[model samples]
Target chain A: MTTEIVIFAVLFLIVSGMGFVASRWRRPDDIASLNEWGLGGRNFGSWITWFLVGGDLYTAYTFVAVPALLFGAGATGFFAVPYTVIVYPLVMIVLIRLWSVSHVHGLVTPADFVRARFGSPTLALLVAITGIVATMPYIALQLVGIEAVLKTMGVTGDLPLIIAFAILAAYTYQSGLRAPALIAFVKDALIYVVILVAVIYIPTQLGGWGSIFDAAQAKFDKTPAATDGILLNANNQLQYVTLALGSALALFLYPHSVTGVLASKNRDVIKRNMSALPAYSVLLGLIALLGYMAIAAGVTPIGTDVNTVVPQLFDKMFPDWFAGVAFAAVGIGALVPAAIMSIAAANLFTRNIYREYINRDATDAQQASASKIASLVVKVGAVLFILLIDPQFSIDLQLIGGVIILQTLPSVALGLFTRWFHRAGLIAGWIAGMGAGMLMLYNVANPATHHDHFGGSAFALSKLGLDTKMTIYAGFLALAVNLIVALLGTVIAKSAKVVDGPDATRTDDYTADQGDPRVHDLEVTSST
Target chain B: MTTPRTDRSPWNWLLLLPIAIPLIPALFNAVEPRLFGIPLFYWLQLGFVLVSVAATLVVYHMTRRAR
Candidate 1:
């Protein structure tokens, strides 16, 4: 009805058409293999990988929820910058090794790497389950991004949301990872245009950067809490640091991110992308400032949804036509990652659970078919997560999702470096970390959002009997407990003469490149 | 272009610098000494992105063998 909505719908439909046709983009000889369907044939060079990975990592969540975070709570929202900036170099150090070894062993997922490196199917199962459950809320949250834009545009109801997922499901089921891979080009181009315009054009109209900061500072300073200022206070700085660090640690551990990485052509492609990926972090910084601009523009969210602040600001600040482009940037933005996530989750299920446990002798075509169906089921499940459950509760669960995924750090991240810990020790440590993380997450309450339990990630130190209001990230604390338990379990297992499990990886496998003789060939379908 | 594992350069350690730099709050948390009227807290963090991209680039090039 409105110009913005019309433009958004037109652009969205055109892109969905492109996604449908994307099955032919790189056309493998046999498109039904798990390698082709799930990973886009592992042939993306630097440029395509750049766009795909960028689109997948910086989601609709970054555009909608992040600025809303800044709109609601001031300085802590900027933690997104450090979280993304630090993640690349940290992951680059370990991820090339992951890329190399996965290629060498035909590993399709991180859990595949775990199964090979840890030699324990139980640990691998735990890692797989963690990746899947954490990603479900995340996929659902992407819809929230679209929902906010739609709600702001006067479009409401479950039908539109269901329609959006149906389109996403159709293209993804038709083309697999290639669908999102092709669609990401459009998503990133639109986002870059929208971000460049908003960051540059809007500031001049709303006085300037100084006034924006001043407004945000004034609003936060008027609040009684010490934690809401534009500058970090001592009380909440601990939360900021730990939350950022913990999030950065969890970023790549998610199955979908590894899907992006493992889909690249070779080690060099990954190496190049890591350094270049910070470009998105820089874009994220500019996007985060949109919150302050919203404050200066006097944009209030519709009712209680703080996530609508950025979209509402766009509607008010931009002409209706341009606002539509901004909305499309975010709406299309959700598709790239959500599609990839369901595909990744499906791959994990089909590879680790469905194949490893269900039918060990399942053929490649069967695995691909199963993954395609599982991807559809995952999408429907994500939609139900938003539709049946309270959407705000979905957001809270997404926060808890971060803490859930962090429990895999010891096995996924550290296991990339060493296999010294006995398999059972790693398993025990995971259980303790997961249990503690969940318990801590359950106790976190946010008076602002009015949730009594399972509210957020920041846990107060006083809860553990410390004399302070200072709180740290629950994921950070849970990870510390995990490492300690893992170390203790390792010592106990070692003294008890419990032998470490077999490691299928060789020392040289860590450094293998694309051309290395051991790197699994794309044409090889036989099991080792 | 693939360097052998035994011949890997020590320059790989430079990767840690960029990762560690952003974690230290005292380094970039200041509000004053602004850039383009933007606070140091904001612009300086964006500056760290450039710093990181540069560090990663250098390590990538230095370790990469000439074909």
Candidate 2:
């Protein structure tokens, strides 16, 4: 009925149609194959991989959450900008090795790689379950961004979300990786246009940077918090740096991030993508400035839900129709990444857990089928995460994910470079890291607001009773504990002469060309 | 993993500039002057994006040729 609604409806119809038809965009002759269906035949070129990985890594959440945090917290939120910038170099170190090893071993998930790397299926199973648990809420958070846009447009009923997700599910089921990969192209294009326009347009309307900075400074100075605006200060600087470093380490470990890596055709593609991917961080910095721009424009922070600030700013600044277009950009942005993450998580469940534990000798067809079914279930779980439970719970769960995935860095990232850590030691490290991180996170609470649910700091030196306030992410502390314990455990294991399975079949295998005859693609399916 | 270079390229050292350009303003907030009819803070930050793009393009080309 309203102009915003009309524009949104038209945009939704177009995107939904793309979602449905996306299932057929790169149809393989075989419909039942996981490699063909889940992974787009593992043959994306540089350009497609660039867009797909970019879209997956930078979500609507980044667009919304980063700016929202900047809008609310000031300079502290800028850590995201730096974390994204350094992520490329960090990824460059690990992913190339991961590509070689995974390519050589034909590993589908990081857990699979761990299984081969350590010759310990139990360790691999823990890694697999961790990936799934961490990713589920991430998928849900994507929906929250979409939900904010819909709620702003006055589309409150569950029907639209259900319908929209139904379409996403159908297309993803139909097309697998190609569905999200193709949709990512559209998603990134729209985001680029919207952000470019906002950066240029919003400033002029708000009377430029001088007024914005003054307004923000004035507001923050008067507030009880010592710092003005969202920038980090002495109180939070350690938290900022540690959180950024910890996050960069954790980013590539996510199943979806690995999914992007494994989908690349060869080592060269992986290397090229790593060097090129930092470009998104540049975009992210510009994106982060929208928070400051909003401050200058006198944009009021949206209530409770931080994701709505950008959408609200668009609605207030742009005409109703263009706002709808921007809304569609944000809405569709969530869809592309959510689809990929679900599929990646589902693949982990099928290959590592279901087949390894539930049925030892499941055929490739059965594995593929299991993943497909599991993907649907994953989507359903994500939907309930947002729709049934409090959205804040899911966001907090995402923070927990930050801690959860960091535990893998000791295993996956370190394993990429060396086997010195020992198999038993790596397993001990993972458990110790996980347990310490969770307990610290559980004990973390912000006393000021009485909001106790999501209080995990990147690190708090004060908590450990050191005189100097050395801020670090809780994950880093957990990781340190892991390393110490693992070292002790390894020395003990070595002294005892415990049996260690042979190192993954071929370390040299990773260095081989993708065209090698030994490189055979495997498909997985599950029997109902 | 690829072997670490024994001799690092000066160009790789130059890579740090693009990363630092945006932060320089914060460090020298007292003296930096405005440019292009835009405030110093705004213009410097915008320049960071341009520098990042150029640097990213360079990295992409270099990596592609490394093969």
Candidate 3:
């Protein structure tokens, strides 16, 4: 435990040192501008942006959760593998257009695009607030990942976590996007080393591949659980497929994801990233197998928490010193994504709400300062959420975030493809999607367990006399409803002679690449 | 003026080659033995690092050409 603490402490200092130095990496004379502070000067090349966004997307939760889920639920955990596989193709289709449109309109947040598209500040505010609300618990889940590692290392007390988050907030507040941008290189390097070492060395430590599988199958068969140790089953098939498709659609709609896309130098970079980023998925498949290995190794479930499985597996398999290094790897993994998510959420608040509503004529520096302060506030809020609320409950809430953010798809993702839906129709679609999504999510109960306050599933189609025995992720179903309502509303508005706003932006502008003089950075003011 | 005489082909569908390269081994592992003297799982995973680096380089070159 002391070794783990020492390694983590050293890692925290190193990460903070990187953050302080990152302010000068791009060497902007004034860090007050939103372009410099929030978006890292919008000058990231293919390699840096590739690592930054890749590191941002594939996170500690992934390192911990994918394996944990596989360990707990068997083959269903591999949903992460396929979901990631399809994400790039899905991103390739949508994000290039989003980048072009955002670049052309000087839009910093999706809500800014919504405001300009619909000429309704109210609708934009709704989108912005939805983004921030959805992003908050997601950030808290990163802390949950950190907490899982800490607990597995037998490190007690809240002081260490509080100190860790304080350091994270300080650097994030000081360095902004550049902090994550610089740290991503080191984070990816460490993760690759740890995972690689584990995949090879751990199997060798436990007998061999055949022994691991044989032991796992034997344990599952004798454990009195109905299902055996195999990957597929009649019960979980629906959940697996729907969860994957739903999560893939939800991934790029995240404000942080779009923020990453917008920071790129051109359209081709977006396309290249979309195609190339799935390289991590190949790594993800191997990571998922660690779950099965832990089961085979006679490692009893420690802490009764799924997230702690990987850390415990490490603690049992490796030396204390190496286990400390692995703990630091997972811990640092959480920080990179958590920092990016908070900044992205804060940008939505500053650009869409604080600037759009609170102070319309605010300078660029003011926007940057507001975003910085808001980011710290957001991180602190996430810390309070994880500490005060049940960590398991917060993780379940992040699944709900998956549902809520997916509701934005028709507006953000589909909007990138076409503008035929009227602003009124889009707003109506959003309200209905959100309303239906929340109601269904509220009613979802884990049938396996007895505690019934707001189970993660929205509506059990089974109760409606539907023949299907599968549970659908409520957000995916809500978006289907959103699309139908949006189309009908579009037709109604077209026939009713509603006043349409002037189309200041055209579809072709989205297809436009870099070197267009119209796309330029906006300067900002420091709020403090 | 930008040169616009010939070669208006869409920017190398082969630029998408990196995405598919990983899947090839994923397909191979579906039915094979002794990849690098380890089972399909370990070899395929360690192989991804090398594959990712190679693909990243390929992508970097392709993207650089477009610039």
Candidate 4:
């Protein structure tokens, strides 16, 4: 085996050990309860919560695909930076309310909040299903990230992925959320070191940033008009803005991101982390430049897969030992988020679906065990997603996932502040938004790839009957349709005297803190 | 049950600045005005990240004091 592969293997083994050891890191009074197993007993302070949430939001996908997008396209790929940049401020207002309400109600999932606030199990079920479905492709993308790194290291086929995911599944099944939370510290630290070194060292070695940009510009100038160029022209400008804003809105709506916030100890932790988390966006900006660096290095991607640019760049630029460390960073980055995504999805299934439907009277121990088993099943499904389908298709599904999850924003994020829309109206709006989004996604075909449907997130404004040549983000347009339908539906529902469900949450619940009377201790709840 | 906040604090309004920075695509959508050999589109966005971090920090401190 190569030195790179050997170092990568050693680092992976160490993280797997950490994942197993994490079950006892903050050992709760009872591991059999969902509160302890699913959320690290909801006792994480600022630092652990920072690493955990940071590690969760910025996945291996960010490390690989963002730069890959930049390497392939020109300026438009930088959308990841602005989207991540804006998301912190956006979530700062939104998530503190979510954290407060979830804490007061002892809620484990976003759907739980939806059910309580809207008093509609059907709406909550849709939220739950959306969370699960959105997360499945996201988890599969993590595997794809690892597969890219492994493929560059000359390890092909499914064995490496299966082995890696097997290790991840075992630890997650054994320890639940605690495993990822613990492993995140090491993962984040390694990624920071590797990225920092690459950003500083690689540019200097390649004759400075000027050459890098010059090379990138020269390469793009040769490509056809409208797609290439180092600058955003008028045609792609609207797509860039809408894509960034739509992503900012959709980021926190995902179950894993919500799960990260809900796992914190208090509102203060969430707020502090929000302020602190923008630091990653700075790192993301640097990482995106790696695409330009690849151009300067004359690093041709393996095959046509642009995701291989980063791995190939590192292999060409850095020494074998360091390349191994970089590979390990990407590989471990995949495991941390994948573990959290599966746990988040499993929590949704257990709390919102299984308990709501299958066994309403399940004990705490039963619920925890059910979540553990469900996590395994979710991981297996993600593995099959990568194995059975095209990995590129999974990436497209992730874009659609963003579009679908954004539809839930009106109900979940908006409901945290108001009950203005009737629950029925909100449900109707979700259907409208989802339908429009899917139809738009279906009609967007890339003739180059022979994908008759679901090709990408960008659609021409002309397709929507606008005369402009500019294309807009599908998610943003779908959201617009969703909101209009929801507003109209609310008017109709209110005039018709549709009976609204009872609100389970009180006014104070929206601002509840750790010491609040409504917030139950995990130990106390476990014994009940 | 405690009532929700009815009085909107001005400090909370500062948070909107960060959200507004990247929404205007025309602001930093060019390549000529490069900083340290990096494109204006790239470096300016990176600068916005720091601005956002500062805005968030200011908002967090002010709101926590209010609470």
Query: TM-score for chain A of every candidate model?
Result: 0.95, 0.91, 0.92, 0.94
DockQ for the candidates, in order: 0.65, 0.20, 0.12, 0.68
TM-score of chain B only, all predictions?
0.82, 0.54, 0.42, 0.80
**B29-58 in candidate 3: lDDT tens per residue?**
321365533344335534544544454445
Instruction: Give the lDDT of residue A485 in candidate 1.
Output: 93
Ranking by DockQ: 4, 1, 2, 3
Full-model lDDT for every candidate: 0.82, 0.70, 0.70, 0.82
Model 3: per-residue Cα lDDT over A1-528, one tens digit each = 677668866886787799889999968877887767877876777687787778755576577777776676565566666566656655655676777777777777788777777677767787888888778767877877787787786766775477557766888888888898899988888888889999889888888766765565566677665433443455555565677678777778889988877777776666667656766776777777788888977665544567777888888888777888888888888888888999899988887788767888888788888888888878877776565444233335466678788777877777776778887787788888888887777667654344453555435578558896656667778888888888888889889978765556776666656666665542222222
User: What is the per-residue lDDT of model 2 for residues A323-357, given as tens digits with 9 covering 90 to 100?
Assistant: 98888888888888888888889888987898789
**Ordered list by TM-score, greatest first:** 1, 4, 2, 3
For model 2, residues B1-67, the per-residue Cα lDDT tens digits are 3652221234444446555544342442331475534344334444454565566456545644353
RMSD in Å for all candidates: 2.3, 4.2, 4.6, 2.3
Write the residue-wise lDDT of candidate 4 on A1-528 in tens digits. 299999999999988888778888866788788878887787776677677778865676687877877787778888888898899988888888888787777676789899989899999999998888777767877877887898899877777687767777888888878888888888888998999899999999999998999999999988785665777888888888888889889889988888778767776667788888898888888888898899999999877666789999999999999999999999999888888888888888988898899999999999999989988888777777565444333344456668878999999999998988899899999999999998888778764456666667787889878888887889999999999998999999999999998899987778777776778644344333
Better of 2 and 3 by TM-score: 2
lDDT-superior candidate, 1 or 3: 1
How many pairs of residues collide in each model? 0, 27, 10, 1
Clashing pairs in 3: A364-A523, A364-A524, A364-A525, A365-A524, A365-A525, A365-A526, A366-A525, A440-A458, A441-A458, A444-A457
| TM-score for chain B in model 3 | 0.42
Full candidate order by lDDT, most accurate first: 4, 1, 3, 2
Runs of candidate 3 exceeding 4 Å displacement = A157-164, A222-229, A380-397, A446-450, A454-459, A517-528, B1-67
Instruction: Provide the TM-score for each candidate, comma-separated.
Output: 0.95, 0.87, 0.86, 0.95
For model 1, how does the per-residue alpha-carbon lDDT over A292-395 read when each residue is reduced to its tens digit?
99999999987777878989999999999999999999999987888988998998888789888898888889989999999888877777766544433333
